[model samples]
Target: MSNLDSKLPELMRQATEDLEPESVDLVERSVAQGTRLRQRRSVLAGTAAGVAVLATLGVVVGAVQHFDRDGQAAPAGSLAVGPSATPKPSLPSKAPSGPVATSPSANLKDPTLTTLKSLLQGPSRTFSMPENWGGKDDGFFGASWVVDDGKGGSRVEVLLERFKGPARCAGEPGCRTRPDGSTIRSESLSPEYSDARQKEFGIVSSHVEITRKDGRRISVASYNGVSEKGTKHTRVAPILTVAQLTKLADSQAWQFPAKVSK
Candidate 1:
């Protein structure tokens, strides 16, 4: 009796082995689909968490700008985030302080240019000229004066030169040197620019030269005839004594030009 029962159960298992294959395959497919759905749900939850974090940061930045004095006082390290203002340039209210540039030729105006307009008035003084004589041209270095003889004769003149080189013509004819390094000279000549100058306007000149300790030399000359036939040609000889010429040369007036030139 027990053998038959056990044999009957074994026969039933053998009959279903081939027949259950389709049902077993359907169950396995359902289980794999459920597993794939769970994996997809997990990845979706991670992506959703990332997106929420980025949204929270954007909201925080907006709130900070709203409280930052209308964006005027932006937070530190925020230069790249705003339209910053550029500074305006300002002008100076006063002259800029600095060294002023100067040149070798800037000379002050000398008052002698006006004071010596009328050289001599009436009588001959130490060194004198006619009343009509005045300064024709003058400069920081020298001057020229002239007078008409009232006889169609050559006009006389006085000329000054400052800073002459090493006292040349020191002891020529009619020249003398003093113990104080001062020199005196007298010269007479005839201009043969044709016989008329030689006869009517022979030239006589008296000069005084003084050299200072600083290698500065001043020369003053008085001419008895128009020295500038080339320019201010007066065709008459000037009237003055050798003593007068020497006195004029020794006068300090010649230094005014040199003083202002510096």
Candidate 2:
């Protein structure tokens, strides 16, 4: 045997020689201490891993909930993912009901209004006119037409009046100048202000009135009904545009004055 191996029991006896005999029995206690330390370390590691997993889960859940409440969408593993719903179509607005377009037509002329009885001359008759006139009426100094929109329901009347009054534009709307240097005002009549007599004619009406630099005024109204007492089915959309009404209202025939043939 090697020297150290053979002297191991003698060395143990020499090392324990200074200790009391009652205090030397520690082999079982050392093993128990080592086992307890290993168990405590293992439990601490397991607890830390569990806390980490819970923290990760909390972040994921919070992120998912935030995205859910927001306008944007979350990924597939998120809570209750679904496609966005489409919005429903809304209703159309209440528009001024009328024909899309008035069929092409020429100004209708009554024999009396077809000619302008000029003060300078006897009767000057050269003036542009739109055809398809339903009918015509001659007044003392004004003239009117049924604007002959064969459709009926709305009686689009075009009236040319020798504005007997001054060019008062203080309370008017849409006042502007035309290419011809005449001041014109396009006015819309409120349907709500319609009296019982006015309702007999139509729903709504508009007019174009113009005053020349010479203070001569001419008025034209494209109405829904045939006349102040015309029916609704007489015509629709007043059968004309602002330009057309202004042209008719400011016709040289009325500006020059005939003695507007009734």
Candidate 3:
């Protein structure tokens, strides 16, 4: 008892000597540390949510830039400068002012008697001068021909002379105006020759008279007889019809006589 009691006192004394009051408040420190940890966790969560929102906005902007109004992908150079940009307008072209030019006719040049003869219808043709016409004395241009086309011989004549007034029918009917302001008078004449032989032969004539736009008169006549005042007729009708005589009168082959100034 004495040994045990003495060791117990010494152990109690040593334990009491080592024991002291705590410098910090343990419960308050624990609460403060927990509050700081909660604040750090809230900051990290907010940062992650902000980064996710930024990534989603970037994806939307990229998609809008790649597409066009029709929702299709845009070509390189065909893209618009901006969403609200407008396109430019186009303009129209101009037209010409003056009248178009045209080529002159070959018939406008001078023509020869051979050229006239070539225009005649017959295979075998013979030309003759009715008189000393187309001279400075008469100032006329004319020719007569006997054309035989295997049917019979017939007389054809053409005459050109200066005329002053507007064309008239002179009581003979069937006068008409052509498109180019020329006038035409066409007729068929009964036998009026006084020659007994011509009367016996029974002559007929087709006559065409044309007044040109320049006031020149052209007369074309065809006879069933060999000549207008000749003896014999070889055809029932004139070799040239009234239509043919009109065409021959209308030809530009004749050289126009120069105007004589008074």
Using TM-score as the measure, which candidate wins?
3
Best by the lDDT measure: 3
Model 1 over residues 1-262: C-alpha lDDT tens digits?
Answer: 9999979988998888777465757878899999999999999998899889988987887677775758566664575464244322211111111123111232224233222333432333222222211122322233333434353333333333344345444446545566665555543332323434444544544444444433344444444554433333343444445465555556555443342222
lDDT at residue 127 of model 3 (Cα atoms): 47
* Per-residue error (Å), model 2, residue 31: 99
The reply for model 1, stretches above 4 Å from the true place, is: 1-119, 124-140, 148-174, 188-197, 200-216, 221-227, 230-236, 256-262
Please report, in order, the local distance difference test score of every candidate based on alpha carbons: 0.44, 0.49, 0.62
Q: Residue 11 in candidate 2 has what lDDT?
A: 97
Candidate 3 residues 106-162, lDDT tens each?
A: 122223334456678455655443221243355555555567776777777666676
Ranking according to lDDT, highest score first = 3, 2, 1
By TM-score: ranked, best first: 3, 2, 1
What's the lDDT for residue 101 in model 2?
Answer: 18
List model 2 lDDT by residue over 1-262, tens digit each.
6999999999999999988755455767778899999999999999999999999998988887787678466654756555354332211111111223122443344432343212112122222222222222322234334444354423233333333444445544557665656677665543422355445544565666667765565555555555433344355565556676665655555424333332
Q: What is the lDDT of residue 125 in candidate 1?
A: 29
TM-score of each: 0.36, 0.37, 0.49
